[model samples]
Target: MSENLNPAELQKTCLYDRHVALQAKMSPFAGFMMPIQYDSITVEHNAVRQKVGMFDVSHMGEVFVEGPEAEKFVNWIFTNEIRGFEPGKVLYGMMCYPDGGVVDDLLVYREFAPDHFLLVVNAANIDKDFAWIEEHAKGFDCTVRNESPVWGQIAVQGPESEKVLADVLGLPEAANLGFYTFYDTEYKGKRMIVSRTGYTGEDGFELYTSIDGTVELWDRLIAAGVQPCGLGCRDTLRFEAGLPLYGDELSAEISPVMAGLGMFCKFDKDFIGKEALLAQKGGEIARKLVGIEIEDKAIPRAGYPVELEDGTEVGIVTTGYHSISLDKSICFALVDKAYAALDTPLSIRIRKKVFPGKVVKKRFYQTNYKK
Candidate 1:
């Protein structure tokens, strides 16, 4: 954290200088000084939709788990099956407490060795998650280290990501890594980890390199025809893809199942939230996550009330944005189970006036993945 920044401590990412040099609009996000847009939000958002764009996601947290008991520790703590994920593969999962409340949503990337792995978590929840994981691994023969400060991450996403990466990034048979898998490589003599995973619903690669090499990598990619995208587009892109944001769609009070991530849960595995999730499964689900399309021009915002025809509030909007792809206002909500049906008519209370809306399938935008 830097001393010059205020309240939230405007942390700097590896590409902070590049953003300033590009004359980007800077803002505080998740306690970091991030570029909200380089040119314009909608223009950058549309650029990524059509071509490859890079993001400075170095503020994300990276934790290392090693030793013989690493696998056991992770399997017991996360609500996903680790055994099924082959080495060099990646899986999406959540860390939950005993009561089934989510700690954070994370991507678990298996290393070349079974006893080693990297956990990429949200920036804001790094300390909380690291403390929790460390305390849980007390007796286990595992070492948990917070390596976020030493590393930097960049997400190169969009339809043309493959072409851009193939030209700029040098790795070992790098292009051959399957989707959701990663490969060890070297860029400019520095050891790097390139994963075929990205938050955007686009076919892209996430490059993890040493903090020292961050600026060079960003420059190289930009020179290789990858546009620098900002946090604004990142949010709109992920939201349009129906990917849940940590604070909005998931949190300490929100269960993964309630966030429309029931498929990621392994019922057979006895995880921290297994008991509660199982109990909730046996009975009817009280609330369900759904996507809503606003018909009016008013953009629905988070914390807005979701009401029915009779003006009865049924849910609350969790995330909302103007979709560059859909050309409409879109939002996600945790509505009562009965209101989760597709095409269900609903209204979003915006500035005291109800805007017409309807529940729709979440994949509001499609992803282009390399087969």
Candidate 2:
């Protein structure tokens, strides 16, 4: 667990006050004072899976790249192919170091023109990511600007997300968006960006608007009976859906291929870390990320040692939980390739005792993403 930081030093989002009023469990995460949960993690987790729920994701970072060479610059830095990306299209990929270690996973939104692109990154990596991109923009004939402070984001997710936005928020554009797509629209004369994207692995939409607009929209959604969810459930939801968390599933030492996310890496074009990732993809990798299911009720957690029956340590657990949706002790672990095969016997060291387990598919619950 990360040490608790001083609240006075933590940044607050536009919805900070609202979360406080709701008596949420507040914590310092990614340099921001944010809500971890409103009611209980289970309740909030189920709310989004079964009905409509809203999350104050204003802490996320946004950067813009605009110029005649925007496409080239983006393709150069990103692992995904974006050569023919049309406006309103969103691509999920990662930035990597020369050694193929992940810089950060992000979403790239091509807005109305070929020369304009929006990069939404994890809040914790805002400063580092912005600096990295800016430093690399030296000769790209483009400008890089961190627009995180100027924008507030809200995600309305789950099965009833579309209906909630259309009826409560009065945004008909929400219903028209396909998965990984977005559009610019106006609400009460204020410009907003609505995208069919979310972290919860449900059919949902993320709304990016001004700070004031976020406050107003949050209030309206609350009055319309949308459950206000927090970050605690968000982690569990994403984990169950097999979505990777930046610091956990991926990191500066963990490449995309090692984390089982190689499909997003386009090999046809040159990007930072292309050579190393290509070598990793074509040859042998020492360790690979895999899912482990503990037979006992004891929950595995991050940093827990994964061992074989002979008590030989093989890997470490990256993320784990007593899955809220599946009601099982499951986790994602970075283990030796020999131990990553399905049905391979393994043991998770939970406290003093070692629990029996086996490797399984990382997706504990099937996602309901509307494509």
Point to the candidate with the largest TM-score: 2
Score each candidate by Cα lDDT.
0.86, 0.93
**Could you tally the backbone clashes for each prediction?**
0, 0
- Model 1 lDDT tens row, 64-111: 999999998998888889986789989999998877779999999889
Candidate 2 lDDT at 297 equals 82
Clashing pairs in 2: none
TM-score of each: 0.95, 0.98
Please identify model 2 stretches exceeding 4 Å from their true place.
1-4
Give the Å error, residue 213, model 2.
0.3
In model 1, the Cα lDDT at residue 333 comes to: 92
- RMSD values for the candidates in order, in angstroms, are 2.3, 1.1
